[model samples]
Target: MQFKDQLDFVRQHVKKNRMRIFTTILATTMGCAFLIVLASVAFGLQNSLKKEVLSDDTLTRIEVYNDGNKEIEPTEIKKMKNVNAVTMNTLIQTGNLEANIDAYKGSPEVILTDFKENEKANLKLSKGTYPEKADGVVVGYNVAQILLSKEDEKKLEKEKDASKINIGIQESMIGKKITLNWKNEETKKKVTRTFTIEGVGPKPKKEWEQDGTIRISKEHEEALVQDLKTLYGKKLKAEEMIYRTTAVYATDLEAVTAINKALQDEGYATYTVSQQLEEMNLLFLALKAGLIFVGTIAILIASIGIFNTMTMAVTERTREIGVMKAIGASPKLIQRLFVMESAYIGVIGTVIAVIISYIVSFAANYAIPKILYMATNEKEFLTTEIQFSAIPWQLVVIAAAISIGVAILSGWRPARKATKIDVIQALRQD
Candidate 1:
């Protein structure tokens, strides 16, 4: 028979046993759906975690730590291949450095860094531009919030509920001049310097994180050091001006591994977000494999029903098979026809399962977070984007392959039996 004729034959047989075929297909559909939904949990969690990791700035940053004896040189690190920029921070050793703008004041940590290198490292700002002059400075996002007037400070001290105190710098800090005051302990004298606010740093990624720091250019820091030395009439020790943090920015994410390796080989200890993600991916891969394995058991169970249905189909059509063989039908054609019927069931079931799986995934992703929030009363669950179930196209392909492969295998013996039926013996059946 032609391919079209063979398909017609299978369709007629399926229609004749529509109720039985429907029931078998339902079983297969449930099996496939279960497999997809189960494995989808792994896919969803992996995607969520991967997104969170990639969102971090540290993904392309490799933090290099001095191995106690040797300090990391920014110039040497910049010479490394694929290194985009090297940024380092040194804490100002002045005691109790206080920043002031008009009547508002805040005591923020003073860090000295190279603005040119920071710009190359993709330093983000919420407002304004990086410092252009030596006396210009950049303040953290929370600096304005922390800068409270004397009256507001008293209100904060009296108020048991600190949140009730609604007092923070309302005006924009850009272009405003801020005063820095620190006491020279040995000299028992106070020193003051005025610097213009050039920019504000971007908000912290985590809600709990507070960025209340003031970053100054290296020239300004050197000037301050010189002033302190002039007042003390002595030279400051070199170790006292050591860098607190050194981070190497890779040219791109793909370059992080090579740069990190190069730094480690040079005897510098390094940490990268890419390394953490690699470990996390390996863990999730194993979890997905285990879930898929567990799901395959359901498909195997469903295949047993397909096997029985195909066997019964072969038995019931024995007289028809005999008639076909007596006329002109080859044994191979008869076998192929039976196998195609089983495959039809698999394809239809797989298609329906995929649709149902996607619907279920959407419902789970939507409802699970709300349910969790209701149960735990944690507001974060409602706000945070969490995927409880995800159905990727690759997952659908895997499920289809396994379901159809098992379905075809289950019908193999029945098709072989149909081919082996003797024409006379099959025709003699009542």
Candidate 2:
């Protein structure tokens, strides 16, 4: 028989046994849907975690540490391949530097860094530009809010919530010169320096984080150190000259691994967010595979229904099969017809299952967070962007492949039995 003729025959038989065929298709659909929804959990969590990790600016940053034996220098790190920027900072051990602008005064931590390298590191500023001269500096976002007059300080102390006190230097500090003074504890000597407020750093990433440090050029740091030494009558140690912290920034996320490897080879210890993400991906991969394996069990159980349906189809059509054989139809052709019918069932069921799976995925993503938040009363569930279930195109292909393959296998024995029917016995049946 021709392929179209075979399809017509299968269609007529399926129409005659609509209830049985529908039930069989339903079983396959449930199995496929179960598999997809189960595995989607892993995919959802993995994607959510990746997004959270990538959102951080530090994702492309690598922290470089000295191996104790060798010191890490920003200049040497910058020379390495794939390095976009290298930044180093040294914390002055002296007490907090008291900054003054007119009547307002505030004490803030002092950080010394290379301005040229910091510009390449993509330092975000809320207002003004980076320092061009040694005497120019950048103050943290909180500096303006914290710099207060004596009266403002008294008002803040009287308020129950200090955050409610908004009476600080509200005017812009850009292009204004501020006096920074610190006293040498050992020598009991005081030194003061004037610096122009060139820029204001961006706010901290975390809600609870505060950025109040004053960033100054390395030249000022050297001058301050020399003045402190002259007063204290002691020379600084060699290790003290090394930067307290060094970070290397990559051109992009893809270059982080290469840059980290280069730094490691040079005997510098390095850590990157990408490395943590790689490990997370591996774990999720295994979890997803396990979920898929469990889901395939459901498909295998559904295959039993396909096998029984095909067997009954062959038994009921015995006389029909015998007549076809007598008409010179090949056994292989008979087998192909039965297999095609089972495959048709698989294809139809898979299409329906895919639609159902996506609907379920959408519902889960939409409702789960709200449900969790209501149940736990934790605001994070509602605040954070998370997916409880996700379905990708690749998952659909996998489900289709498994469903169709199992359907074909289930029909093989039944198809073989139909081909072996005795023409005489089948024709003799009343």
Candidate 3:
């Protein structure tokens, strides 16, 4: 038979049993939809985690600690292979700076290192410029909020404080001199000093954001450390004194492992995001495997239903099959007609499943983040802006192909049976 004639034969068969075909398609649709939802969720979670943990900072960054009580020298660390930059949080002595502003509730304990060249890469600034003078200090995004008075904080809750909340006004916190009261730890004498705010950093997206921290130049930190020793009348050894923990960022992500190894070899304790990424991958891999296992059960049930339906279809069309055989219709052609009908059912079912899955995915990604952010008023609570269900095109193609293959395979036995019908015997069936 010509291709058109064969297609017409299959088309008529499907149209004649539209109601049964619809039922079969519905079963397959439910199974495919379950698979789509599971796979999309798995992919979405993995994508979100990659962004949150592996953002610009952590991808190339490694935290170095002096677990052996030895001094960590940044200069020495810089000489290591793949080490792009090294910076330490500075310890601001209360002795040098008398007191912070009364409006600022907590004292800042961390300071940004004054590396002339790589400072921009190490941090993201939201406002103003880096501290250039002895009396200037930079603040983190949270620190900016901390600078507000109790009254202002109450106003923020009501969205009433419009002045300071503005971007330009908030950034204008720079150059404002905040008085600090410092008392000598041993002498019990109090002194006062004022420092100007130099810059403000953007809000932290992850734990890596140095929130509630302030930045002073490295020169000022060294000078303050020296003054503290002089006031206490004691010589402090490097081992006894805790300076700061340094973060050594590699040139790129691939270099993090090598640099971490180099740090460990040099007798330093180190932490890297790369190690965390491996653990996360293992966790998601297990989750995906579990989802696939559950999805396979659904598909198996659908396949059985479809196979049973196809078998019954051949029985109902017995006389038709015999008539075709009597007309010299090839058994292969007859078999192919049934298989193609089943495959078409699978294709239609899969298409419907994909459409429904995407509609659900859109609602999930859009609403979840906003709902969480409002509940907690914390950016971290929202995690990354990852879709709750992100179905990639590659996955869609693979799923469609699987559905079609299952349909064809499941119908094979019934198709073969149809081809084997005895012409005279099938023709006499009432």
Candidate 4:
């Protein structure tokens, strides 16, 4: 048959059964829409999970401690295989400085690497030089004013009270004089000295920002902390010990396990982030798969419903099918027309579903952001934007396959029945 003849036959019948056609298309559209939405949402959830896992700073820094001992022996640690350079910094309990700042003594909060030449690596010297001359020091802003001063001047200025100096000396206050005090723990005697503050660091984080506290260079740090340790007769931790080595980064999980054995042989301890990342990654993978699995089931149900509707359509038009065959239309033409109708509905539904999903995504993405702003009571959380609009190609492909294949398959039974219909009986039926 000519293409025009075939087209006219399909269009005329479609209009005659307009009500059924519209209902079938509606169901298909809704099914497609549901699948599209499911796919997009799953993609967003996966991305959000990734952000949460990677945003942590601690994940980047491995925590190394004595495997069996409370404190690792320096010689034992040094001999361990796969060992990176060891660095020591005290990890004291959190406390408020004498000036009233809430702080973690040895945390990155109090760690400073601000000299101009520090980029060449290894905390190098800069203009006005390193803190080595006469006990001068480069310190973080928090504890800058505490050395010789009895009270914080900044605090007093803000409160307008001569006694309350609330602000810790900031980084700009470098090159100022300050007193540091310590005592030998074993001797139970006190020792104190003063020095010129050489450089300052950035303002503390919100959690770290308080009335007063500070970080000092190795020279000043030793003068203040070493004295207390010696007096107390406390040994330094291996992680807290300083060894300048050329190697970079903590060991991987597998390498660490092997190194652990090597360390045992050498009487040293091992450390790596491998164990922690492995555990976290496994959980994340399973979680992502579960979400996608649930989404796929939903899409499948929708596709199946669409297919069933198309099948019913082919059945209802059986009498019309016989008439078309009697009027010089070939059986092949009849089948083609039925299949084409299914394809038409499937295409329309897919297109409409794409548009609908995009609109829903925009509104949902915006609504959550606004709600978060109101709840957090802070501007930072509100401004932390995430890209949630991910078009899942897997979903689109699945929809296309399900819609087309189901439409054709469902029409098969009805189409074959129509072909067997006796023209005389079909026409003679009431």
Best by lDDT: 1
Candidate 3 per-residue lDDT, tens place, 1-430, comes to: 9989888887898899899999999998888878878878988999888777876456788888878666798899888887878877655533434235544444555554764534634665888777767778776677655555667666777776554563212445767776655556568765445678878777776555557766666766555555555554457643343357688888888888888888888888888888888899999889877886687677778999789889998999999999999999999999999998888788888899889878878888888888988997877656656668888897677677777778788889899999999999999998
lDDT of each: 0.88, 0.86, 0.75, 0.53
Instruction: Please give, for residues 1-430, the per-residue lDDT of candidate 1 as tens digits.
Output: 7899999999999999999999999999999999999999999999988888777666789988877967788899999999989988888764656788999988987888999999999988999999889889999999988888988888888885656667778788999999988776777776688889999999988776799988988776667776665655457653564347899999898999899988888889988888888899999999999999998999999999999999999999999999999998999999999999999999999999999999999999988889999999998888887678988999999999999888999899999999999999999999
Candidate 2 vs candidate 4: the TM-score winner is 2
TM-score of every candidate: 0.88, 0.84, 0.80, 0.62
TM-score between candidate 3 and the true structure: 0.80
True-structure lDDT of candidate 4:
0.53
Q: Write the per-residue lDDT of candidate 4 for residues 1-430, one digit (tens) a residue.
A: 7888777876786788777777777766776667666666656765665565554322322335544554454445545565544444443222212222222112122332223223222433233445546455455544444432224443454576433444343444556655433434445565445557665544443432442323344444454445545544467543343322111123443455565455446544444444545675687567545654565455455556545655676567666766877797777777777777667666776777778877888887777777877997665556654646555677567666765565566566556655676777777655
**Per-model root-mean-square deviation over C-alphas:** 3.4, 3.6, 4.6, 7.2
The stretch of ten residues in a row with the least summed lDDT in candidate 4 is: 99-108
Ranking of candidates on lDDT, top first: 1, 2, 3, 4
lDDT of 2: 0.86
| TM-score of model number 1 | 0.88
Model 3 residue 242 CA deviation (Å) reads 3.5
For all candidates, the clash counts are: 0, 0, 5, 21
